[model samples]
Target: MAQPRKPASRGSRRGRKPTSCTQCHLRKQKCDRNQPCNRCLQRGVAHLCGDSINSNGGFKHSQSPQVVSIAPPSPSPRPRRVTQPPMSPSLGTLFANRGARAFYGSSYFGHQVASRILSEEGQDLPAGISRGRDTLQSFRDESSSFAQVWDLLGLLPRQKSTVDRLVNIFLAEVNWSLDAVHEATFRSSYDEFWGRRFGFDDLANVDLRWLGLLFIILAFGVLLDSPPHPTLDVQREREEASLRFYWAARRAIVIAPSFYGESTDIVRAGLLVTRYLLYTRRVSESWLTIGFASRMAQAQGMHVDGERWRMTRKATEQRRRLWSHIYTIDRMISLALGRPYAINNQFCLTHEPENVWLDDMDDEEANRAVPQPLSLPTPSVLSSLLYRLAQVVGKIQEKCFGMERASYEAVLQLDANLVRWSEQLPPYFRLDNPDTAADDALPFLPWHRLYLHTSFHFARIVLHRPFLLRESITDRFRTSHEACMSSALADLKIRLRTMNSTNADSLRWAFGAHNLFNSAMILGIIAVKNPHSAQAGAILEDLEAYCENLHQDPWLNEFGMAELKVVELCISKAKDSRYTSMTAYPSGTPPEPPGPRIQAVDGSGRMRPSDLESPAMSSDMSSIYWPTVWEDGQFTFPGAADFSTWEQMITGIAEDNYGGQ
Candidate 1:
C-alpha cells in the first residue's frame, strides 16, 4: 500500500499560488480556478465562492470576477487514492440547518399511527389523506380581503358584553388546562390594551404578541362554549366564528413576524393555535406549529430553570409553568403521531410549576405567595402533573418504538415504571379514588382527572401494545396483554361514561377524540380476533357506544368519519362469516396485500417462536380458542384488514370517487 502523503511545510507552500475558491478551499476539494469554481457550484455554495485562503490562513474576497491562470498537471504524477462515497446527513443535521427548507407534510403521526396499529391486526386501511389543503384554502379566502390592512381591534366582538362573556368563559373553562397566560397579568394588560386601543401610532405600536394571545383566548371561548348536542348548522357557525378569531391571531403573528421574536405571548399563542388545529382535526398543522413553538421556547432559554438566572420568583415560576406545558404538549403530539418528542428530558433542567392558584400569584410580591401542595386539588397542579407523566412517556417512546422490537424485559420494566407513575398520583387525580378536596376545586376538575387518566392509560396501551398479539400471549407476556386490553377497555369505558354524563361537553377536545379513537381501534381488533369471547362482546358494545357519542360531537370531520369506519369495519368482520372466509387465509399462508405497509418496529418480528421463547409459552393454549393462524409453531398471521384501502373505499363512497366500483 502507498504511504499517506506527508504534510506540506510552511516554506514549501509560501510561494504557491491559490488553486480553489474559498468554499472549495475550506472543504479541501480540488476546484477548477474559475470565478465560481466547479467544486463550489457542485456543492451548491456558489454564492460563497471567493479567493482561496492566503498562506497566513485568512480568506480574501475578489470584488469582481477573477481571471486566474490554471496550473498544468505534472507529467506522470501518482493518481489520488479512491475514497468511500459521502454519507447522507443525519436527521439532526437536517433539522438543525436553519437555511434548509423542508416540505414534508406537517401532520406526521395522527393518521400514520392509526394506520400502523390498525394494519398490524390483519388488514391495511387506506392512510387518511390530509385535509390541510382545504384548511389553507379557507384561511386564504378568509384573510385575502384583510391581507393588506387588518384593523386588529375590529376583529374583536363588537359588543363589550360579548367580549366580557368570552373572556370570562375562557378564564373559567379553558385556562386551567393550558396555564400559559397568567390571569393577573392578562387582566391588567387587557384593561391597558382597551384604554390605548385607539391611541396606537399606526398598527406598529400595537402589542402584536398580546393581540395574538387575546385572539387565541377568544377562539377557545367560542369553541368551548358550545351548547350540548349542537346541530350541524350551529356547529358550522361556531367553527367559522372560531376560525375567524384564530385567523386573526395568525395575522397578528404575521404582522409581528413573531417567529423571529422570543416573546412568551407569541409562544403561548402558538401553543393555543396547535390545540385549536387539533380540535379542527388539522393534526399535521398542529405538529408543525408545536415544533416551531418548541424552538421558540428554546430560543428564550425556557428549557433551562429560570431561577439559575436570578429572575424574580414569579418570573421563574412562570417560565417553569410555560416550559412544562410546552414539554407536555410536545410529548402528547409526538406520542400520538408515534414520532420522537421535540424536547429531551435529559437536557431540560426546568422543574414542574408549583401548584399556586392564579389569585395567589403576584409578579411584584411573590414573597407573599403560598403554593398549594401536590396532594391538594388546585388548577395549577394540572400542568405540573401532566409534565410528570410526560417524562415517563418520553422513556416509553425511546424504549419501545425506538427499536425494531423492544426486548420483553424492556417492556416489563417500562410498564412497571408507568404503573409506578400512576400509583404515585394524588388521590384527587387517581381514577380509583374520589376527590375529597372539593372545597376549593374548580368545576373542570372532574374532567381534568379523567383527561390525565386517559393519557396515563394511553401510555400503558402504547407500552404493552407490541406484546398484545394473540401469538405472543404466553404466561410471561400475559401481563402485557392484560395491561393493553385493560387500558383500552378502561379508556373506552371512561369515554362512554363521560359522553353520558352531564359534563358531556367536556369531552369535545381533540386529545379526547384522539385517545378515544385509539382505544376504540384496540378494542375493535380484540372483537374481530376473538369474535365469540365474552370480552370481545363487551368491547363491541363499548365501541358502538363510542361511535354513537362520536356522531354527536360537532368536531367530527372526515378524519372522524374515517375512525368510525375503522370500528364499523371491525364490527362487520366479527359479525359476517362470509366476509371472514373471503378475507382470511389458511393457516401458515399469510397473504400479501397491496396496502399500507406495516412497520417492522411494531413488534411483528418479536412474535415469532424463533425470536422469543419462555417456559410458559407451551404448546397448550387450550383455554383460549381464538383461531390460530400460526403454522409449524411459527408466527404467520395473514394481513386480512386493509385499513388504508378500507379508508380509501369509505372516503371514495363519501366523495363518490369510485364510479360505482
Candidate 2:
C-alpha cells in the first residue's frame, strides 16, 4: 500500500465515521458486540472491543502522535484457532509516550521478527482519498511516520541466516556497476537496521533516504547470489528474493519523492535500477532505464566537473565517478544494439575521476583532502581506469563502426592505439606482467585479468573483422585478415586459460558471457579453414569446453553450439578433400587448384535436389563453393549449406541447355 502524503492533523470529520462496540452497549441496544459487535463488524473491520479510554473512542486525534494498540484477549471464544487481532486502540492510551511499540515483547503478542519486518499488521493507509489527500498532507513541523520508514524485511528470505548468507554472496558475485553505494553506509545501516522495528529504527534515526538505498543494494545482492545454492535452485530462489527487494525499493522510490532529490543517496539507487534490468535479461528495458538515469544525472549537473560547481570534495569525486559509470553503461548497451550514444562526448565536459585507492576512501566522507596514489592499484583505481577504457571503447564503436567507416590505415592505427592503451595501464592493471604486486598472487587477479584480456580481444575483432571478408575483393578493399584471425585466436587461448581456473564461474555470467559470445562465430570460421593447425585444434577443444557451461542457458548456448558444429563439419570436409588429393598426386607435388568445383546433394544432407526445384546460379561466382555461409552467421541461400549440391546446379555447355539452366 502506498503511504499517505498527508501529515497527521486535527481536521474536520466531514465523512462517515463508525460507531464503536461500546457505543451500542451504553445505548442498551442488542448490538451482538462479539469483537466489533454486529454493527461495526459488518464493515469488515476488526473493531476495538474495549470501553473508550479517551473521549475519542480509542483512536488518537490527528493532533496527537499515533501508535499501535494492544488489545486484550476476548472473554468468550470457542472455535478453530486463529491469529489474534491487533490490540485495541484504547489500550494504547495507557502508555504515556508515543514510542510504545519498543516496550512490547515477541511472545507478548505472539509476533515474529519476520512479521515485524515483512508483514503489514497494524498500519493501514487510506487509498485514493483524492479530495482529502491534499488536506492531510498540508504543512506540519514534522510529518514523518512509520509509513515513511517501514521494515521491508518481509521482502527478503524468511530465514535470517539465509538473508545474511545471500548478502555475502551478493557482494561477492555482483559486478558492482559504477561501484554503486559506498561500502561504509550500506554496512553500517545493515548491522543495526535489522534489530530495528517499524517505529524504532535506532540506527537509521528516521533517515528514510538511507533506508531506501539499503533496500536497493539488498535487491542487487539477492540477484547476484550464486554457486552456494547449486545452479538451478540458487538461480530460482535468488530470483524470487531479488524480485521481492526490487519491488520494495521500487515502491519506496514512488512513495517518497525525496529519493530523487539532489542527494548522494539517489546516485547509487538510481543506477542500480538499470543494472538490475540488465542482470535479469531485460536488455531492451535496461536501455530505456539507463537512458532515464542519464537524463536525471544530467539534470543534477553531473555532466559538469564537481569542482567547477564548488561542491564538497567527496561529492565532487562521487559525481564524476557516477557519470563515468553512466557513460560506460551507454557504451555497452549502444554497442550491443548498434544505437547512437546517449552520453555524447561533445556535450559532457565532466573531468574523469583519478586513481584514488578505494580503501583510503572507505571512511572518507569527513576527509576533505584529495587521495594520493597507492603503491599499487586498488578497486577504486581499477574502476577509474576501466571508466577511461570504456570511454575509448565507446568512441571506437561509434566512430569506427557506426556512421563513419574507418579505412584500412585508420583501422591499423586504432589497433596500435589499443595496444598502447594496454601498455599504459598501471603496473597492477596489467596482470600478465611479472610485477611486484603478483609476488603473493593477488586474490582476484585471475578473474579481473581474464575480463581485461577478453575485452581487449573483443575490441580488436570489432575493429578489424569487417575488412576480413573484403580481403578477397581487391588489395585496396582488403585489410589484414591475419590480424583479425590472430586476435580471435588469442581470445580463444585466454578463454581456455580462464575456464581451466577457479574464475571460470564468474566468466559465464553478465558481460563476461557477452564478451565471449561475440567472437564464437568468428573463431568457428577460422577453425574450419585451418582444421589441421595446432592452434585451430586447441581453439576447437576450448570452444567445446566453453560451450559446456553455456548449456545451462539454452538460448545463447544452442545458437553458439550450432555455429560451432557448422565449422566442425566444414573442417571435416576439408580434411577429406586433402586426403583425396594426396593419393592422386604421388610425387609429393599437387596439381594446380581448379577454379571452382560444384556439387549437388538433396534433402538427406548430401543427396540430389528434386527435378522441379532446378538449382539457380549463385550470387558470388568467385566463391569457391556454390553457396557459402557469410561472416554474419547466415547461410548465403537455399542449398547453400551442403557443398555437394553445387554439382547438380551447374549449366550445360550447349546454348539451348545453358538458356534452360
Off by over 4 Å in 2: 1-154, 159-161, 172-178, 191-266, 270-285, 358-375, 431-436, 439-446, 472-480, 500-517, 529-535, 548-661
Cα lDDT computed for each candidate against the true fold: 0.61, 0.50
**TM-scores, in order shown?**
0.64, 0.58
The local lDDT score (0 to 100) that residue 311 gets in candidate 1 is 68
Assess the local accuracy of residue 546 in candidate 2 as a C-alpha lDDT between 0 and 100. 56
lDDT of 1 by residue, 117-147 (tens): 2212222222221122222232234454222
Strongest candidate by TM-score = 1
Summarize candidate 2's per-residue lDDT along 301-402 as a digit string, tens digits: 778787777766666676777888787777776665555667777777787776553333533542544566744544455456556667777867765666
For candidate 2, give the lDDT of residue 353.
Answer: 71
User: Using alpha carbons, what is the TM-score of model 1?
Assistant: 0.64
